[model samples]
Target: MGHWLDRNIVEPGKLPLLLALAAFVLTFLVTRVITRLIRAGRGPFGNIRPGGLHVHHVVPGIVLMVIGGFGSVAVRGHGPGAVVAAVLFGCGAGLVLDEFALVLHLDDVYWTEQGRKSVEIVVLTAALVGLVLAGFAPFGVNELTPDELQSRSIVVTNTLINFLVALFALAKGKPRIALIGAVVPLVALVGAVRLARPGSPWARRFYRHRPRARRKARVRAYRHDARWAAVRNRLHDLVAGAPDR
Candidate 1:
């Protein structure tokens, strides 16, 4: 850990929250700049107003940056590595947002084989995984010491990189790209599971919340089905009563 991530430099508890805020601000600024550049490149003097499609593409990126910024705060306790984690998380968030925005804007031009769909799919998967890890960070590994930085960084970085690579494959029309991209997070998630196992803090929180989540989902499904059942029955009856030649 150098100057940017010195645990000794910042108090453990207060720093994470602050760092999370910083991550958010960083993400916001970076995205705004990127959007501006793209817009400028497409027009003269950048004077032309952006259309709904342009705004649509940028909105998700902005939103994810904001989310990851908060997530950075959550993981601030992980020490120096937290900053690295924050940057990576922010990029992943932005990338995912960019994809969904692009998808909505996709039409004949975007749907074409050479239109970079793979990139969007890869980025979206990475963002989703990053979001998951952001929550898990508090329960995952503690800060990486300077000596351990290289190894741990590799694991985290490779996981993220592989996710992006999978998306690239998807753009090329590869069938298993999404699945492969998903595997990076799955592996890390398993590791997180191991770390949080049984007596660990992460495990305790995860298990405690898991059942509540399931119950809520079940309740929602029951309500939705019950509400729609009568409508479905009416349609069936109407169809059944129709005269046939």
Candidate 2:
């Protein structure tokens, strides 16, 4: 176990990444708790307004992200500098993503149903980053042996194949599958072969001419969504507070 950690994480200089992931997730959770308190009118927190203009958290988030990103690039990947940059970036990301729906809709919808999107996205981002910190590599290339990695042709071929499979999964309207496929190609292949989302580009182009298949796909989607909607909503509320309406 020690050797595995040493080879996969320490040697690859991924400690900063793990730290960033932790900070990102923790920041998001803390931010949500504060916001939830504010929404309930129970906290010392209040809305920030200057000159009758509301100041959103995303502004500071953007600044931090820029500084951290540029600073990291300017400094070496290892050591204290990298760690600091990663922490800053993660903090900024949590702030920005917590208000993602506000940016997307160009409105103050923090307690509305639209705000749930921010929670969903934040959860997804945290999950993906957590996976990375667990030693999964992007594009399934980490599975290559030293000999295969040393061969330019083999590495290139493997990467191209994984990229294509991921793309195919995306084209099928399976974003979650495609994302996982970037780390595990087998998942992508399965997603690519499955039925496309009824509203996806793939279904619009391919299922348009196949009525029975489209109907079945639609039914399946509806059932799945119905089954998970309650659980999803509870999770969103638990993390970001219940919607205003």
Candidate 3:
């Protein structure tokens, strides 16, 4: 059994098929157990809420976890397998930490309306998987070349932008809007990155203009806040003086 576990995991040799199968099965089992605990609703041994499910948060996380777990099964001492293993290990670590946080979040003392929406564990896991897959893809398959790390970087970056959009949408309770925002910004960001590459004509122009816009926005924000502070003070004084009237 000991050798089997290590063979199924920690050593990815002559077992690509087995590793893949185990990765998927293990991922599913782990996720179901975690989800059940999350649903059991409170103590170290309880769920986050009474029979409640964090579907959006938990499902994507489950998918990522499976991908990573199987990847772990195939990780050997070096090369692509090693990289995949490291990524899987990181995912495992994140899942453990997140589960701990979920316990805290479920506690009545720490639970807040905003806290209810935030599942840092799920977000971070998704992000990690995105990064790992991007990095692994460019190096793993024969169809891809080694020099495509830049493409991986772009993939990671775009995944982040999508995550942000999803987070914002979830917070606002507008899943459709969030989906649109997630898709649009990601497409735009990727397009921009591609256009900014060495041979593109817009690359130099985009870089030259991006910073200036940011500076202008920051200056505008400062001025706006200054004026708002003055108005706020006046309103405070008026409210304070109302009793005398």
Q: Please report, in order, the local distance difference test score of every candidate based on alpha carbons.
A: 0.45, 0.86, 0.43
Of 2 and 3, the candidate ahead on TM-score is 2
Residue 147, candidate 1: C-alpha displacement in angstroms: 42
- 1 or 3: which has the higher TM-score? 3
Which has the higher lDDT value, candidate number 2 or candidate number 3? Answer: 2
Q: Which candidate wins on TM-score?
A: 2
**Candidate 2 ranges beyond 4 A from true positions:** 1-8
Off by over 4 Å in 1: 1-14, 42-77, 98-100, 103-245
Clashes of 1: 4
lDDT of 2 by residue, 114-180 (tens): 9988887887788778777776678777889988989999988999999998898898888878887
Candidate 3, which segments miss by more than 4 Å at Cα? Answer: 1-88, 97-121, 135-245
Which one is best on lDDT?
Answer: 2
What's model 2's TM-score? Answer: 0.92
Model 2 residue-pair collision total = 1
Decoy 3 TM-score against native = 0.26
